[model samples]
Target: MLFPVLALIPATRTEPSSLLKLLAGEFAAQVAATWPEPHAAFLAAPAARRHLTCLALALGRDLPPIAERLLGGRLRHAIRLVLDPAPSGLERLLGRLGELAWDAEDYRTLLRLLAQRAPAKVLRHAQQVEPGAVRRLAGLPEPMGEAVGLALELTAEGVLVLREAYDALRLRDGPEAADVAASGWARAGSGKALFEAVRDDLTPEPLAPPHAGTTHLRPLRSKAELREAARRYRNCLGDRLSDAATGWQAFYEWEGPPGAIIGIQRDPIFGWRLEEARVGGNGAVPEAAREAIVSELALMGVHVGRSGWRLERLLRDDVGRGYRYWPPSQDVAEAFGDED
Candidate 1:
């Protein structure tokens, strides 16, 4: 008997009718509060249970508190009963309710509860429901903008259904549907553009490795060696200079022996200057070398305006005075000296 009743309602049926009977039964039990007697009655007559369930669901806010409590419990029980692989005595009682109608609020509350408590059941039920209702329900407001956006995004196909609804509403009302459609289109376009911009911003650029034939150097053998080298270079230069001061600098030329270059120079104000030095191959000199130079200098704590020729010349002069500190055998002075 239970099997026949379950079979009567197709799995796809989403109308309020299918569950109406069960809902009504629960509501009646709540209203009566007699407990065992009503429960026995519900079990005895599955058709009666079905009618009661439908009535209860339709009652909505009109239902008393006792009805709500009883109905809630019964709803939970019906859900569990439906989960059983084999039809139970309560199965027929679970059926009988035909198609049910749910407004936006009802759909939202039901969906939330389903997502939290019975996700699988919710999905199954959604499939059974009317496509139009499902589409509308999918568009219901979400607590978070992202969630709403995602819902709209996932149900893009449902837009047609919404459009139909809009049309119907418009016929019944005025230009409400047209306005909604326009707003939806505008928002979607803006969101898409914003998403693309963010995506582009996050995309990484391809990194090119150092050019072939470029010289490279490791740092000094130890911090002590580096300090001692700095001190010695400073002594040779005989000047107190800014780190940007090219008279004294440290760098590894990517030519010849490929090792450190330390410069010692005399400054007008500072008696001695020590600086790190670097020698670049012809390839290192760019058409916009000044821009590159300024960019590199900025990275090294040197502040200079983009078009400051005076500052550029000063930097070039200081860099020229910086000497290669690597041993003669390792120096790129000869190999990398070409002006080009």
Candidate 2:
């Protein structure tokens, strides 16, 4: 039992060296208080390894019970988060894990440990939160994984935009992509405006002018923050009321007859990029409504991008039943089947 736990900790205090040790030692002290002198004596044998091993054994025997006590029954849920294949919650969840310690170094160590132990999960998580992280993590040789991991902990949001840039470069120029990307990442600094330089470098361009309303870039902090921004946008609309729902990638809400659509995506430099509100109707958007939408976003401090807002229509389904939200490449034949 102790060997497994011991094996996980680095002898040189590298990677998750600090966090794993701290958690192990703290857990040992807690269990030692409850056990009899003999069973718990190993916990205080005046040597780090002995104590860690003793504690690991005790916790292994009663993991669920101990986890419940430590995490208020949320330990199972947290562990489940670790097992999840999706990359979206890795950084946030890992941070939540070490939040009990409230030390930046501890949080970073835990992050490094998780990535080392579960590279795939870490890769996805970093990709979801900050593509630069995935690029940085991927390009690194084994030794630098931990060091870069620490850097990511500090600039998680700043690196989100790097994913697309890195991916584009990778597609064009395979393994050698890391050299150029890493240089950009090194100069990324605090991540603000980090993507401004690479936005054009992307094969297709991230800030391409939209055919619809003007594209404005608003860097919101979180999904919740985007919703709040949408709410403020509604307030700016004055009396117009429409049903609204916010999703991970975009915010869709009905406002009056024409309705409105705001697209959202992750950006490491600015956090989240929100498109300027667009008229969501089949017909031309009324000038009044367009002004109202643009005005509200501007007042809220969202930066207008390269293009100005314009009235444009989205493609609709045949028979005009509703807007066709799916991409053009979608296989409609497979979707509806040969039965029709």
Candidate 3:
């Protein structure tokens, strides 16, 4: 009986890295308390590999749980964000806000904003908001069924306009208009140059150059460039500022003739892949341009695949519809028939 009891006992698991806990600093408890066990264990597993980026994120003290699940729970892509440096908008926002304002709801809202629309706008508005802005700006219960339904429900820029409008209204329409603006975000309107001057946030940005050769991808570095591409290409790409700004989706212009815009997207399931290739008025790419784009992206380790298995779905009377995307090539890059 004693021998059997001794055999029944299992060995204890080893603790995670001591460095991870130590570097967690004042936020160690919050980190230990908040992140799920697997993520915590994952964080701890890389004791020797812990570099500045990991340390930076650990100190950030407020990022998403479950979601930072970058690239199959591997730190390779996640750290490359810090290494090669693309705009990881959430981290930048949290760093701006500091630890005190790091609420989970705010994190979720910012994440939603970064993932969906107006990431640059979100970053700008958050930065400019008055002290205690983080607490103030986060719309509770997250307004239903709206993109950027922020601050009495408006885009980040729209919120600023509302604030400006309310300030003007308060003086003209008495304290009522002013009161809301003072307490929180607000709105007002002017009739026929009632206020002649409000400078827009627009700033000059360098334009993407025409490609010397077949064409290569160039990043849309500013709101000006994005608007210009939208105007020049006449594509349905004007609204993706947040997606690009946050590195969830990125917009690039093919630097040559006929003017095409390229969109590269990173998804949990589909790491980095060419999401769209559009010319003027959302037109399809010419074969030469498309092939060139595909070839270049392949060099960068991006897949330029299109609907192969998905097309097979209709043939077999499958139950699911493939998500719509601008097909890169007339020829299927690879056949991965959609599984219903």
Candidate 4:
């Protein structure tokens, strides 16, 4: 389950610190105390465990403690998905919620709504409903509660769903929907009007992000294979290949040896638009070369965007830097010599 929050905010690749793991463990335990079934099931899955670990780490201390159980499975599943890449608007909305000084009750209400997978209709109704309804549901005062609740619901469904919802509402309710838009709903970034500005035709479906709990690197057998891969990529890109260099320059500016090797891998953290690659040789892969490779791939539309591959250093002695090794680890290498 990917967090709907991943769509908006960028996830960091840095490994979780011990402190964060501690916090996540405590939170998981608390959630278990209230709703044990989901928590136990969550612990059973390694990938889901990693999701919780990463999110708890990324969210850091800002992650509010779990005080009450609100349909634990949905909450736990959503929480796991929240670590993976998700809809941008939902991610931003979740970020705002994290930033707030949440009380126990606030967490309870928000978690409940998330568990329900609040529909766009909830948001539309939220706007039309009286102040009492807003206050009762969101616990915030009057219009603010209505706005936030609606935004939260739309975010849960993702930006695309939100757009469809708003479009349907406008077609059906007309002024009622307009009235909601006019009533400072746009003040919250999740609101319909604000979302419209950022909305584009790009859909998230085509982007093939790597599966969770997988290695980022894909090894090449030889420089010949590498060149062939590059050529194929260039051919796929055609004229857009020119933009590849520019795309590469946007992220890195360092220089390195010409013969130095590099390995492009999908990022384990962040969105599909971001990546992490291994740079081999005496020093890190030069910015110029990185620019060339990434620019071509990006231009070809192989990656999520123009600037996606994040570069890293490969240890000088690491033979795996430029070669294929199934299982991609020493355990496999020990079982069957390093080379195929």
Best candidate, TM-score-wise? 3
Model 2, 143-218: lDDT tens digits are 2343354345444444444554566667777646644654555554444434544542342312322222333433
Clashes of each: 43, 7, 6, 11
Candidate 3, poorest ten consecutive residues by summed lDDT: 194-203
Residue pairs in steric clash, candidate 3? 118-242, 119-242, 211-255, 309-336, 309-337, 309-338
**What does the lDDT come to for candidate 3?**
0.47
Ten consecutive residues with minimal summed lDDT in candidate 1? 206-215
What lDDT tens digits, residue by residue, belong to model 1 across residues 1-340?
A: 8998988875442222323334333344342333333344333444434333433444342333333243344544543332333223223323422333333344344334334322323434342433343353345322112223333344445444444544554564457534543344434444454333222222222222121212232223222343444464343211222221232333222222322342323333433222224332222222233334334433434333222332344455444467322332222222222131
On a 0 to 100 scale, what is the lDDT of residue 25 in model 1?
Answer: 32
Q: Candidate 2's C-alpha lDDT?
A: 0.39
Evaluation by TM-score, superior candidate among 2 and 3: 3
Model 1, CA-based lDDT = 0.35
> Given candidate 1, what's the lDDT at residue 208?
21
Q: Model 2, which residues run further than 4 Å from truth? A: 1-39, 45-165, 198-200, 203-340
TM-score of each: 0.22, 0.25, 0.33, 0.17
C-alpha lDDT of residue 319 in model 4: 38
